[model samples]
Target: MVSFGDSKFVKKVCGITQASYQHGWDERNGGNVSLRLTAEDLVGFDDVSEVKRTLDLGFDAKVLSGSYFLVTATGRYFRNVISQPGLDLGLVKITDDGQHADLLWGYEDGAKPTSEFPSHLMSHIKRLKVDPEQRVVMHCHPTNVIALSFTHELDERSITRLLWKMQAESLVVFPEGVGIIPYMTPGTNEIGKATSDKMSEFRTVIWPHHGIFGTGDDLDEAFGLIETVEKAAAIYSQICAQGGEIRQEITDEQLGDLAHAFGVVASPKFLS
Candidate 1:
């Protein structure tokens, strides 16, 4: 008897979108989120039996054939998700051929998945290969992160180091470092592929001058990754606004020590 609006996944993602919007991260329809679903997660949903509609994915998602996802809808605003989950979200099952998806629930007004759905799927496929337990792929436009994107070098190593130095826990939380892709048009296969390539080694990817993509075993982990990075970026921005006077900062050796203390190996590729 669980309705679409009553589902926990629906509630969680919607709440996240609302939080993102309230935090001023997702403006308008600028950000989207997708969470892979398991059979158990859909157990109580009585309306998922048949396809409500079908939409082309525009890219091969065969690796995810038969998989189910609860995702935001196209042109939907995050602020309204919690208030109207049925209209702002949808559950889709990847078609057998992977070129399409069958909408099973929600999207009340016939809206489709986010235009960035391809990117979400692409990153999901790559991240799953990297960590089979991975289940969430989130993208958002955090103001501070976008600001850092312009103020900081677009190089992955440099940004990684900068974020790690900005906070003691940065290296521990993202030991593999963050990946950065060249700015390209969003919602395209090309951007999707580039982000997928980065996902091969990093759980977090930065879309320079745009936003960020984060993957994790669950919703909180995915959101946490992005949250941590955003916080670091905020600190960096404030430092600049305050005259860029740095009496001190975390040193490389200290970062190594912190990583060892946390038992997560910092990326040697990024660390000096």
Candidate 2:
């Protein structure tokens, strides 16, 4: 059995958390990541059956019963993850009933999973129903995306169209567009449910005045989705700062052409 410290999963989590911190997306303990792990991914780790401890999920998650996830720990700083992964991350297996999880590795400091664990699980459950391959859910307070929530209209259609117009790659990266949820207390079942409901239709969801939730088939895909959207938001913020006036921007027809060229469908509602 390979040592947990040398496992590829541990290395991936460390790298991502550190990179996120470097990008300024995760400050202090502000962001969290959860990756669904398959049985195959546990091959190098020893003693899968051993449970270091059990944690109550606070809510039923029977839909994800028996699944394993690698998640960041609560109150742990992303900047510290690379240097002390075992203390900042954990490997947990959802109980057969899903009301609890068993720690299989990591979490060396006896820390619990992220406070948003339910939110992550909620997203994973919904995303899996739509895209069975979905494996990662990432949440962070991206400056521009959060700023736009305050200045721009919260109407999903308008925000989606605005973001699509901000960058040519925006439409291609998230053709279904983004989902917007009115301000709701984070880390609660209500917000988790709202975010999950949105995930049924869109891969990205903006928590008005807070941050964004992005899901994908892997960590990179999920992180890239958030990064692309945040970049567009940053461009929009810059334009607004220069002068909240738009002399020219990507038109609907051009968006259509770009989508066609990319062989991807832009959101019909936004396009119209």
Which tens-of-lDDT digit does each residue in 158-208 have in candidate 1?
989989999997898899999999999888889999999999999999998
Q: What is the C-alpha lDDT of each candidate?
A: 0.90, 0.91
| Candidate 2 structure lDDT | 0.91
Model 2, residue 10: what's the lDDT?
A: 78
lDDT tens digits by residue: candidate 2, 173-248: 9999999999999989999999999999999999998899999998889989999999999999999899889999
Q: Give the TM-score (vs. native) of candidate 2.
A: 0.97
Give stretches of model 1 more than 4 Å off.
none
Model 2 worst lDDT run, 10 consecutive residues: 41-50
